[model samples]
Target: MTVSAGSRTLEVKVLSAEGLTVDRKPVTKNVFVEIRAETLNCSTTSLGVADGARGSPSWNETLMVEIPPYARSITFDVKCKTSMGTKSVGIARIALSDFLGGIVPESSLQFLSYRLRNWEGRRNGIINFSVRVKSAMAPKYEPSVPVPMPALADRGSCGSQMRVPSGEQHNPRGVVTGIPVWWTNHSANP
Candidate 1:
């Protein structure tokens, strides 16, 4: 399906994260953020893991995402890489309405914060960010005319249609009347 010109693109900046906890202990280092959208197309983040400097991690990264008119929300998955494996610290779901509520002007930056939820549905931390919806060009409507299809050839009778070689014969219902070539070959060999 073709996207209309009225579709918007979003600019999301992940500023920082704070007050994170994993297994009841403060997460002071080795954390990374994974950003994704409800639509399968757009998701991005800072390239490498952000090391917490003096126990505070600041990503301050910017991502430009194409927000189709049908998209509803974007999700953030915060994880920490450890010796064992990556552990889920928290997740945040930000609605598109938060930025496109019609109260804010197009292409204006708005900073916001959301409470992060862990795997067990417990509060884990807070993520700070800014979002802006890029202005879209007005849609141009054009008149559409349907094209006519070509006519097919008429096959009056099944016997008049093209037939394959061998003893097989096709009836009016298009079913073969004679035995198949495989059975005839086996019977002849036996």
Candidate 2:
């Protein structure tokens, strides 16, 4: 007697006053759900199955949500559960900024700018099974325009080499000194 919700699948969805809000604020709502039980019958446990799957029994319930305004753009936690146990769910609040921040233009620069670096892995807890799509996108500067070398000015003349000031006493033991000009310009150099 393997009671099954015949060809059943649990679909998790979120709906609110509107798909978006007017004042650009988190639109609070009493979320409503319709549980369509198809396969599993009476005795089967909603333990677990697939990723992002709410391993639980079907129920028509309402949950409160604070859909943050786009200007604030936030991610908050929602505690969900089946008849079995509680699970942590994250709801992300999006706005114009979120949309713009995510859209990458189809260009070579876009490819070079946003590249995957490293993955630190997910959180650790009772419900630690989660995924973080770690990605980085940056604006690519066109190699500083190459400077062009000013056409060599005289061609037969000599060029200048930036020299460190000879008079400055360097504290080689205590604090490193005489760092390159560009290196010193950065905040982390000091």
Which candidate number would show the highest lDDT if scored against the true structure? Answer: 1
**Residue range 1-190, candidate 2, lDDT tens digits:** 1112211111122211112111232212222221221212211122222222332222222222222111233222223343455433222222323322244522112111111111122221121111111222222222222122354433443333333332215211121123222222233321
Tell me the tens digit of each residue's lDDT in model 1 across 59-123.
78887776665567888888887789989899998877777755687678899999999988999
List clash counts for every candidate, in order: 0, 11
TM-score of each: 0.63, 0.17
Task: Quantify all predictions' global Cα lDDT against the true fold.
Answer: 0.66, 0.24
After superposing all C-alphas onto the true structure, candidate 2 shows an RMSD in angstroms of: 22.1
- Model 1 residue 147 CA deviation (Å) reads 23
Off by over 4 Å in 1: 1-6, 47-54, 135-190
